[model samples]
Target: MHSFESDTTPNRQEKEHPGLKLALELGPLLVFFFANLRGEWLVSKFPVLATLGGPLLVATGLFMAATVISLIVSKIVFKHLPVMPFVSGIVVVIFGGLSIWLQDETFIKMKPTIVNTLFGVTLLIGLMFGKSLLGYVFNAAFQLTPEGWQKLTLRWGLFFLFLAVLNEVVWRNFSDATWVNFKVWGTMPITIAFTLAQMPLIMKHSIEQDTSGKP
Candidate 1:
């Protein structure tokens, strides 16, 4: 559970609350999904919610708010920003603003697809160059054997691509509200399950502690 509070520095580190970390990451997403689902009722009860116009708009605003809340909580409780979430927050703010000002929900929806696809492409490309970018992202959190990193990196790269394809399918076919729900709830469960399913490989391939005591 302490992984939530874990320090992200290369030199200094702290324990984190894993459950709390997952909660913070997923909580805002659920908010956006539900908000989109019941957007009409929300707008009716609180007219302010309607200022954003329809479900997509409401979801965007809620998404932004939830992102901020998650960031603040992570800062206060964990005392540092989680690397991935920090990067994601920046993207959300930029894309969310574009969605609002442009009055196009497509921009916000594209956020995930773009981000995921970029990650996918970046990892695959990096691999071609014989570089392991996932090492940079998760090295601080978990110490894995070299083989472990390679396997994990490959899996994540493919997963990101899968998400991109899934996003395209969802948004292209479904309504805005449905797409938002899918983006949040749908992605979370799939990602977590995917992550958990990797535990065996991670455990099996993980590095033994370095004699020098550094990963």
Candidate 2:
């Protein structure tokens, strides 16, 4: 009997704690949602927040703070900041700062569109160079062949573009409250479903089983 370890397998020190990872990623967005819902009360309680403007603006400021904190925590607890979340955090700070400074909610609203489009473009460009950047982000959980990584990266790249377009549509046509709700609820479920839908491909090209019999 023999067991094989993948070159891409996460080291013991780098093994991800899924629960913590989810909390770190979603916690800031949750804070943003709740802040929007209780903006008035928050403004009354914290006089400083008033300077930022109405509820949405206040939420944007708080969202930016929470995003920074999440990244810090990820660095401390996980030993390294995740690539995608770190990129997202940078955009959040930039757009969130603009929203607060100029008192324009549109900047913050466009944050998702910008982040998703950035990811989409980066992934597609990486593919053109024969690099599967998605593997770096997801290799901890599973290893895939070169072709598998290429396919998965292409799908995710396109999916991010779709999400960017969807964000533009929702924010442009819907109420602020509705847009916030969709950000928290709608995107998460859709991403989960997309990830689940990729299971067949994942299983088909899993490199772990292929290398298991090696001496």
Candidate 3:
């Protein structure tokens, strides 16, 4: 999880809490996956959940709750919420609410598309104003030159737009199970692969100094 702070220098507590950070970002996702798998059992026990429709609807409610909890925990632990996740959480609540109220899966399915597109547009707009917004998210992880930040920001913006389109294609054309599986198995791996693929660029732009003290 990216800590959402303007301060380039992170405090000691934030620096020491990577495990909590990961939990905040990934725990809700895991809950969503598990809820989808066991939604029938969940409804059987709760009974109130039936009004929300099938397994997907139940999972959507649980997903929304988990997302809110994740954000709360993030704020409490890090004293700030990462902008992207915060925005994502807001969309999750709104769309998830609509999904439950209307008993329609389409709303929940569109959540990713909306969130990704929002981020993609926000990044592109920041770039238009001569801001490398991605740098704020990644400054703690690596130091890159101005040109490097520009290149990386552009790549990520386009990648986000691609993800938005991909989500639309999957959810619109595929079965619910397939969409859920794709959200978990497909997106995570693709993102990791994309991040790894950027290693060459990252290394080229890395500001690290040689141990031998030669520039």
Candidate 4:
């Protein structure tokens, strides 16, 4: 006997467990990272994923598969997609498919550089336009004072630009294997360090839990 009146809040069921969301997002990156490291073994097992016969190709295929799986998991478990992952997934598919079909790793290697730089420039440009676009992008994560949002958005915009530059430098100067390593493991640790350093910033601007941007 289902009631006509809804028991759940509008557009809200159970909140997604944050840890779960993080795992879904990070899992595919790990697969790509590890596959690149032990690419011979992975390609041996799933040869079709490596028709192009390059380590980078194998890693890109795994990354694309993992992105799809992550999105499906999020949709099923959280009942909706998160913004950042959705954006990333779209980029991965487009870039990954291009890399596969072109049989060139450059397309995949350039994905992060393009995505990060675009985000950075777009955020900063939006600010110049008197819009806190970061607010729109991360509204689900935190609510901040007007001043706080401005400062945080500025810092994040710069950070993204730095990441873009670093990616370009690494991929340009290093071999494909080394570049892949940096993309996953190296960038992750750096991001963790930066996130930890942002605790103070988060505290300063934080509102109530309901307003903290976690669903």
Candidate 5:
């Protein structure tokens, strides 16, 4: 087993500015959002965009391109691909490609549900095997006791499943614009709130408690 000291810090090659990391992660989503919102105008300007089907389809294509670009940029900047984004990127490319090639929006709409479920199941399965895979995703952010890691992993796994269900609920019953709005606006705030809610647990289990009182 790796020590807490070794598990907390990211490897040398994976180190990067937090802002850059945030940008790379969100850039593709932002591209998808803008492309969908401005699809008609862009289609008018480009003229060739109409051949892609519609606003949502155009957005899907651009979203795929942007996702791939962000992953490449991440590799160039950090010298390695981060696990979560890389997985998400792969899904975006596959689903987005299908959406465009087949001229169907359903695949693009279902991407989040699929990605979230994949993460949820993977984490839960890892826990069943006595492994806390969340550490791989958030190791750079916090160093906690084994108990904390287990608890956090379980919470995130369940939370991911909740998001998958939520995506299904939103996209299935709502219009495309509503779904897009919720995807761009709703999920982000909910995730931020969930992360903030975990701070108490993080503080309580922090490894610093073990060393803070040393003389």
Candidate 6:
């Protein structure tokens, strides 16, 4: 009983709930940030948490849990998992698990590098194959011409690789707190600025849809 439009277009709730969606996506990172900041206090209250290794390790475990919870909440609310978050969550769990299992911080520290590189390479490869894989992430928000998608995807792919290299340089040289701070605070602002910088391109190639949903 569903038309192609109904099947393809985002549901009303998904389109209207940007704030909730943002919260769901960022909630895990915020949890990781605060958990690292107050990790010792948490351990003092619940001595059992000490078994996780240390502050950073405990933060890693909590971050993994929070990511799983966020994905679950997203699925329940939106009836689908957002692609980027899902992919990021999978990498977090893998790296976090390795960090905790081996009592090695290196794995968790390299998580950003791995995830960003994965995304960057995947996007670039998709483009090489004449696909704009970024469409899956933004298709709900607006429609873009094929050229727009290609340009946007190329920019994002390179930006992601830049972030990967940046992550490597920071975590390799900085203290744990400094790296965590950069991860939570620095990266968000940089990404937001980069996204804002892309507005002109988006505006230039955006396809207008009519009230009846025809473009």
Q: Which candidate tops TM-score?
A: 6
**Would you list the C-alpha lDDT of every candidate in the order shown?**
0.80, 0.88, 0.87, 0.79, 0.86, 0.89
Tens-digit lDDT string for candidate 6 (66-161): 999988887777777666778889999999999999999999999999999999999999999999988877876789999999999999999999
The residue-by-residue lDDT of candidate 1 on 87-122, one tens digit each, is 678788899888988888888888888888888888
lDDT of 3 by residue, 64-144 (tens): 999999888878877887777888899999999999998889999999999989888888999999999989888876899
Q: How far is candidate 2 from the true structure (C-alpha RMSD, Å)?
A: 5.0
Task: List candidate 6 segments past 4 Å from native.
Answer: 1-11, 14-19, 210-215
For 1-215, candidate 2 gives per-residue lDDT tens digits of: 21222323444534657677678889999999999999999999999999999999999999999999998987777666666778889999999999889999999999999999999999999999999988877887788899999999999999999999999999999999999999999999999899899989988888864556767
TM-score, every prediction: 0.81, 0.88, 0.87, 0.82, 0.87, 0.88
List the candidate numbers ranked by TM-score, top first. 6, 2, 3, 5, 4, 1
- In model 4, which residue pairs have backbone atoms overlapping below 3 Å? none
Candidate 3 RMSD computed on C-alpha atoms after optimal superposition onto the true structure? 3.7
Steric clashes per prediction: 11, 0, 0, 0, 0, 0
- Across residues 1-215, which tens digit of lDDT does each residue of candidate 4 receive? 22211212223433437677668878999998888888888878877756855877888888899999988887776676666667778899999899989888888999999888888998899889888777765555667777778887888889999999999999999998889879888997987898788779878987765646776
TM-score of 3: 0.87
Instruction: Report how far residue 187 has shifted in candidate 1, in Å.
Output: 1.4
lDDT of 5 by residue, 153-192 (tens): 9999999999999999999999999999899889999999
Worst 10 residues of 6 by lDDT: 1-10
The residue pairs that clash in candidate 6, if any, are none
Runs in model 1 deviating more than 4 A are: 1-20, 210-215
Give the higher-TM-score candidate: 1 or 4. Answer: 4
